[model samples]
Target: MGLAHVHWLLAGIDEIAAFRLVFRDDRTTDVRGTGRLVWHGRTLVWTPGGPYAHLRYTVAINRQRPPGTHFDSYATPDWIATRALHLFPEINVRFRTGVAAARARLRFRLPRGWHSATALAALPDGTYLVEEPGKRFDRPRGWLLLGRIARYRHTIAGLEVTVAVAPGSPLDVRGLFRLYGKTIPLLVGILGAPPPRLLIVSAPDPMWHGGLSGEDSFFVHGRIPIRSPDKTCSYLHELFHVWQPFHPSADGRWVSEGLAEYYSLALPYRAGRLSPQTFVRGLALFERYGRWGSDLTRTRVPAALNNSAPLVMHWLDHEIRRVTDGHRCLDDAVRSLAHEGGTLTTASFLRAINQAAGRDFTPLFRRHVYRGEPPPERAREDDAGVGH
Candidate 1:
């Protein structure tokens, strides 16, 4: 084999706080993979050579790395390979001939905090191949994320993918998400397109932010401090915005933010990760925090929709659902706008809303979104569940 330099690859596994690489060559020459290392999960144990590998693993009870700090956590081989198999049952590997190749078979298991899988190899082209799976991808039946990066030395990938954990946190989905919150939305909004890449968080240091400049990849500064426990949904919310059409007039801000918020809870809710009660609690918090105080009353409102639109949009959703007897939701209005192929304005939005409501909601639109008037607070006590 050509003299091997350091290498990397993207693979998949259950979940983990960090990953450790162990490689053995044909000569059984063993080299424990180590570096500015950082950052896997699972319910079912993986079987060897049966499409997956299961290795003994453990969670980091308190492994939260500060915004700029660095730490290391290693995974057993069984854990790494098993997860990889599920992510790519039909694996298509492109390793350099004789330069370096990770062992094809391995085992992995779930221990505590999380379990993960990864592959490390150096290519002849001066690029490293790092593979991992169980990532987020919008592909049909390809939701399972997996890939390898062609990393170059002294570049973004050349820097170590540090391992980290947020201080005073558990492995709860929401908590783990919040650990990398604020930056994820901005990153997703900017980079979440085609050619998705793995995002490695080494330690919880705020200053470690770096990634590809293209409209497809993002690298979390693993060491950044967790700003709030509730910002966990920001990443998913921002990612969904990628599908929305850009509108200069309406800017799709209402639909984009509303849909983002809608899916933020919907996905987890559907997956049983969140309870309806808890979801409503989050909506309550959004209203109380009032991130955006858009005047719903003005027919022509001027404001970039972000965090604030969710609450008001939720209120609109409730009204629509109730008035339409659950026949239509905000989605219908947006779909109508999309099919019409026109920029959305106050008048156009109202037209869509009226079409979905099956009547002229001009008065309601005037009072609600444009006039910013209080919804029929007295009409139905159950309406109290809604907000604006």
Candidate 2:
């Protein structure tokens, strides 16, 4: 039998504390110029001993999983899978000369029978390139998967897509590709920027029961279907998270999640793959869970808050459409929010809404999200003033 291969993106960069790297040789293998590596406690410090200095390091791709428990990253003898950010250690160093702005390349030397894929740009000669203009040291971040795996690669609607699964997964990879190919393109107009590539990895029972999203990548349990009979889709929800450009603060967590969950059903509905009655039923399912949710502004469990969040988006989208005479909709506000950039806050979210609607939605938010009062019901499609 062969190993599994998967691609990943860094999901939680803000909370990564121990950016650990695995070493195999003289630590100076990837280092250059005049700098001495210093170790203080568990932290590694570096300083330029001379002009024109650069440092580099390598990480071991192997990870050990707990025995029969749910985890995001884990490994068996046949393969290794986890967040690249957790695998590659973050470096802290400075340079006085030479452009600190340089691109990073990842070249792999896998076992004789193994294959691998990554979320980074595929360069000529089979290496991956990592270049982020905003950061000094572009650490290898995102999901990293390697094992006796099978990879299905495609280019649909100009987006590079890779679906990796264990050799015998029951997942319908072809159906999933058809679904994503049909719906992901629909998000570009409203979401502003779609990831140039998307990495989807599916494994078996030992993984968490749900899906988790990373940068341009997401992990899902193999048992999950393309679409449930209830009309909700875990794959779509996580894919939305990867496609999302804005990062909302704790107070506005629902804005990001609500949109992701809402669009999971909405995109297929808009694509005519899901019936209108089924779409409405999906919203009702979210509403049913939402009734048990706590306040939106508090730091409560996100799953609990998300039950009602999509219904709120449904109503808000309708409200924006009604007032704008079909000229603007919730997408207008979402675009506005995306333009603001940086960490998204509740105030910024409200400002985006007002900017899009040309009116205040503060009272609405105060009534619903903060006070825990239910948002008003969405009007009928035709009366909503926006074309479906």
Q: What lDDT does the true structure give each of the candidates?
A: 0.38, 0.68
Q: What is the lDDT of candidate 1?
A: 0.38
Q: Give the candidate number with the greatest lDDT.
A: 2
For candidate 2, report its TM-score: 0.81
Best candidate (score: TM-score): 2
lDDT of 1 by residue, 106-156 (tens): 222233543332323325553334443332221111111111212211112
lDDT for each residue of candidate 2 in 1-388, tens digit (9 for 90 to 100): 2222322223322222222223322221233223455555445555444334444443343333444467666666666666665555555434334443445677776778877767888888888888654675575656766778888999876778898886546789989988887887787777776778888888775666678787788888889899976587888899888877778787778778878887887888888798666776676676666754367767466554566777777777878887888798888888777667678777887888888888999888877777666654455344323334
